[model samples]
Target: MKLRLWPDALFGRLALILVIGMFGGQLLTSTIWFETHDHRTLEIPSRIFASRLADTLRLMQDAPDDAARRELAAQLGDDHYTLRWIDGPGVAKAPSVAQRTVENLLGDVLARRLHRQAPLHLMDAELIDDSGRHRGIFSLFDSRMPSGDFHVQVQTPGGAWLDVTGQEGQAGRQSEPRALVIEYLLRIYAIRFVAALLFALVAVRIAVQPLRRLAVAAEALGKNVYRPSLELSGPREVRVAAQSFNAMQQQLIRSIEERTRLLASISHDLRSPLTRLRLRTEMLSDAASRERLSADLDEMDAMVHTTLDFVQGVEITEPRHQIDIDSMLGGLCDDLAETGAKVALEGHAGAPVSGYPRNLKRCLQNLLDNAIRHGGSASVRVQDERESVSIIISDEGPGIEGKDMLERVFEPYFRAQPGKTHGSGLGLTIAKSIAMAHGGTLVLRNRPARGLDAVLSLPRG
Candidate 1:
């Protein structure tokens, strides 16, 4: 089987809209909150501390000679910052183990707090001591810090400015906003998913209310035509549809009632004239003429009666009942045989089916009468399949001709063999109508050996 995928329906679409809107609003609000809170909370404290450390570096750089520079580097070892002095050649020399240990400790603390490792970029101011030729080597990545990296600014010896800033690791650069962003997004999605499901359930329930009403009203209409017309009310568009449907139903009922009344009136007016004609024929003088006129009158009466029966038959709305197929067919065959008509029953049966017993009986009787009238006899069979029951009636008469097999069978007034006036040509029509009323179908097919097969298949209720 091929599967087809279509766009979301009203309920699903509504759910998506609700989830997206809610998630977007929540995400935007979270972003704004984080920006304001993070800047005021952590960044301010780190910047203040950096400024103080820079001030200490400036005092050390103001010392007069290499001796003072070395002493300063030793004194400030781990108290607040590390100090280093530069020679005239600006060469940087290593710091003591104490300074290195303090830096490592600070880096560890930052890593624990921020979930990332970053080096503190506190610069050491450089200056030559009183020995004249370059003092000792002072080490720092840069004295004039640029904004591209995380750095701080501080005053040095001789009123010069030095920039001290942090050195960022790859993980530090990526982790800050990336972790927060993923947190916010996952939260938004969780809320959105839950909201969407709730929205879908509510939307579907509301949307199907009108359909439920329509189904109930339709079922009631089928049971009783005199029931009140359905009222129209719902959403604007749905209301309009409901009104239109109610109007159409009323119109259809009116039209059917009118047609049925006309048929009844015509049958009444027609029978009176037919009765009068029969009386008039009784007064004819010649015996042969009177008999001929009586025969003609009888045919005319039969035609009128058959036509009226067909019209009224069309209006039958019988309630279905459980019927024993085996017994019904068996009884029918027995009746026909008692009447001296050659008929036989065949095939497996004994299936109970739901249908209009009276109407079904009339249909079968018509088919059997047609068979006995045209053919020498008729044979009846019944079989029950998984989905439905099938009844086959076969007649050994000269089977229907080509094209006539399909055409002549169902027409309202058309007859076979031109002028052989026998039936009102309504038997097959009535049978077909009865079958349709029971949600079944009747079909005509030529028997391969010789004859015609009438198959009636009724769906299982």
Candidate 2:
């Protein structure tokens, strides 16, 4: 069940690969951006806030008196910034890990701009809800401000602590600012990500569309080799494959036409000489010589006729039709039974097949003849398979001795049993051709129990 759920088609697997690759690429890009850009989110805002504190201290130091400094500090307090003065050292305890990091960053910025570093403490801002309750440990941010906020306190050389409070800019208070960074990342790149996903889907579909067309064209070729050429599209490799397949199909058609033309020409040319030779043999005075010559001429004529018939029948351009294979096999069995041959038909097919009925029959007749000639008796069974139909013809006589001759027997004029008296060794060859012409196969095997088995498997159209 697990294996079955896995993709079996090219489109499915390719789509899977494309999806994984594209998503993985997006995630990898996001990770790199996160690692490289994280510090900028906190560093710029913190330094600017720290610089503001340094500027405020300088403003206070330049003031005419402590009372005027207090007034200036009060004036600095507004919506976005709050400033206050504290007596002696403030936050007289150990600072937090986050506080240390912010202090170092702010200390460096202050030293560069002010020409000296001041004692500074940075810590979390008091968490506020919409209801204005102090939720110290909890944050309002889930997907937005997960890192939260902070407040800073810098002590001046005058022994007074200057309180500076503000956010870390739009980036937020938390040093990491994970949620805000993620949201920012999404806001910036979401459309591009979606567009990339769509582009990949369409591109993959376009790529696979050509292969599907090629597959359809191939199946059509099997049905009729003379089918129209495939239209070229898709990637370079796919287009090349389509072009090659179409060219091969054209070559096959030309080859078949040339072979048929050659056979016809040979048949027409051979008939005239054979006719003249028949006349010459009839004129011979010696009865025994005349009979022998006549016999030789008859054999030659029969061989030529059989070869022509085999070619013509196998290559017949008949339109395919649905036919009951069982009835056809039954009829052949009846005809052979009339001649006292021990032939029997068993089993049946679920569906009729589309084929050249006459050619299909001729192919069956050849197998039956081979079985009777070599095995003395034949048992035929028609089996229905998922994708094709099998017509198995087994014989009871001696099976072929040469294991290597199984496929060779289907080659023209190549005899399986060379000493056999009844054939021109073209029966299996013709059978194989007829089967192939209908997009089928004819394979001969030595039966395990005894004798030989000739199995003809034809695709169901």
Candidate 3:
């Protein structure tokens, strides 16, 4: 058989979509975050360092000489200081505290040269002394030209005020911003990946629950098992699916009932003609021919009755009432024994089962009669299965032939043993019908050492 590739329930498809959506959302979010924030990650740190380094260079502009500039540079390049200028045109020296290892050798050497310069000197100068503290200032200017003249203000140590300015060294170099930005983006996406996986699993479970229930109900229905109609709940689509299942079940039951009613009506209508024929056969004059006609009519009558009984079995309308199968079977065995048939009860008894007592009794009676008629002695055994009940009736007689063992007995008017004038072969058929009517089954099998065994199984309430 060819199998369809799509899922058959709303929840299953929902779960698939949820998983796909979660994964897609995670991917999209990470992609956008990487695209937008990649450059910002490295630029933030670089901008902070650049601003502080610019302030330190301005401070060094008013220093008295190279030694004072060196002291200031050492102070600015301390472990706690994040600002350090690179070498440019005039002076050159390694920065004292190198927190970040610069990948470009030229940028590091340039920064060292700029730090050694005695600030950028210019011709315009202003002398300002604030208390006894020495202060220095320089104009903010573009770094492309090192000869630009700028104003300067300063206060010397030992309460002296002085101002001197001049043009200084060459402009500094910049490192590539790509690597740090990429690393930061990768870290962000890794965190989102773990979160997305957990969210996807939860989404899958919630979405698939309805589909699981539908699967269980469908399986039971396929097996001809009785299960309650599903509740119409969950998402709108899932509720619609449940409604469709309910409608389909109703249609199936309706079709079965209609077919059974039609068969029953046919059986009932045929009975009148069958009775007349039986009466008419009795009126024949030739004895042997009359007897043969009577037998044929009897068989026809039995067939009609069996057909009606089977049809009734198809309609399961009766509410299940608890019935003591053990007591019922025991009483039936005693009744048969009293009637001079060899029958007995054999096995441990269990609790009562939920079923139609009349149907149960009828099933036992049919089996016992068949056993006694063909197999001589019959024994009824009752036992309990976990959630159900079972009754086995074995008889001691010549066992059925292996070739005819499986399908012979259940068919109407099919008697395996010949030359025995008895009722039409409707006994096992009736028994099977009664068993089915009560939500159970009847099966016939040959006993290993002796005769035939009839097994009846009933579901528990």
Return the top candidate by lDDT: 2
Model 2 has an lDDT value of 0.75
Model 2 — TM-score against the truth?
A: 0.62
* Predicted model with the maximum TM-score: 2
Model 3, 115-160: lDDT tens digits are 5423232223111122211121111111111122222222222122
Q: CA RMSD for every model?
A: 12.7, 10.0, 14.1
Backbone clash count for every predicted candidate, in the order shown: 7, 1, 15
In candidate 2, clashing pairs total: 1
lDDT of 1 by residue, 72-141 (tens): 6567545223344432222234633333433444455545644544334332222122222222121111
Error of 2 at 99 (Å): 19
lDDT pick, better of 1 and 2: 2
List runs of model 1 lying over 4 Å from the truth: 1-167, 170-258, 275-300, 347-351
- Candidate 3 residues lying further than 4 Å off, grouped into runs, are 1-17, 20-24, 27-48, 51-268, 275-289, 411-415, 418-423, 429-442
